[model samples]
Target: MLTVQDHELVAAAIGEAETRTDGEISVVVAPESDSYADAVLHWALLVALLPLALFATFPDLLHWATAFVHEPWGDEAPPLRLIVLFLLFKTISAFLVAWAIFRLPRVRIAITPHETRTRRCRRRAIMVFQVGTERRTATRSGVLLYLSMAERHAEIVADELIQSKIGGEEWGEAMAALLAGIRAGQPGQGIADAVRLIGDVLATHFPYTGTDPNEMPDRLIQL
Candidate 1:
């Protein structure tokens, strides 16, 4: 979703933002937050069992199908073994078809529950914050801006010092600006705008001192 020029733009924005605040800022973008293989399996299994449920609820449907395969001159119903085998074949075929279709990234993401995507994206952003930005600054003023493209989700994680000083709602404007950029298909611009807003907030509470050192890389991290 980002090109070389976009990457450079985001990196430059972060650098510019940090120059005005003691807080450190980092941006991370991901193609997706999770593989969702389990979700795919669940959907495929449901599809495979649908026919069984239908036949169980309405046995007449099964009988109607069996009659088509039975000889018209024969008085006997279709063999039970044949019926079982046919059902097994159909169930397996349905499962394979569903599995194949859901394996695609776009299809899987489209069918995934909104709550699931939001939860996964949040979890990933937290993890990234913990590993890379949390407590890495001298004053615990590190911030991470994370974006998950497939889910169309964004998150901002602040270190202990920033969190103690800033309310979560204080970042609403920054979040809104970021999301607007994303919805407009300009992720780079969205991220840069968010960084600028975040920088203004940080500058208000933690204005840069001449002696403050650059504690983090300014480049945008892509995953």
Candidate 2:
């Protein structure tokens, strides 16, 4: 959810970063890393089970409660229709509540495990690198800086060339910086700063040669 000005600032940051190194850097921001449907379903199922358990475990109690309310008509065991109606009402109410809760973005995200979110972000980042950034240039020196808004996660993926020169963990600082920005509610500034940091690293290992060609697009990708 970046503004036009934020997009322009990010583009400029990428351009400025590329000026110092042959390594091509790309930034991608996604609304979410994954659909998290599994997590939502898990929560929904738990909620739905509550109604089933209550009906199954306390049938006698429920019947008594219903009979108590209908005492004016003479105390009788709850009718089959009444029991079925109560069960259905409870079941439907539980599901409806679950649906509403899961519809909240934060609630769905909270239901997802941290490890799952991290893995999804990393996998998505790698995919973006392979399909969008990798091997596009002469030296195969491409890096992707990716952010997942919902997960509040950031990842760095470098092509074979860059990986050969620097270990993946070397980009930890940049990733941390990006995540910090996100945690602080300043994603744009965080990404911009991370780009600058990554630029510095690339420049150190792959100085811009006069023959370096701009083989990849410089603008930030929004997905």
Identify the candidate with maximal TM-score.
1
Off by over 4 Å in 2: 65-85
User: Tens-digit lDDT track for model 1 on 144-213?
Assistant: 9999998889999999889999999988989999999999989899999999999999999999996779
Residues forming the 10-long window of minimal summed lDDT in candidate 2: 69-78
lDDT of each: 0.91, 0.85
Pairs in clash, predicted candidate 2: none
Can you give the lDDT of residue 126 in candidate 1? 99
Q: How large an RMSD does model 2 have?
A: 2.6
Give the per-residue lDDT digits (tens) of candidate 2, residues 179-207.
78778877787898899889999999999
lDDT for model 2: 0.85
Per-model TM against the reference? 0.93, 0.88
TM-score, candidate 2, is 0.88
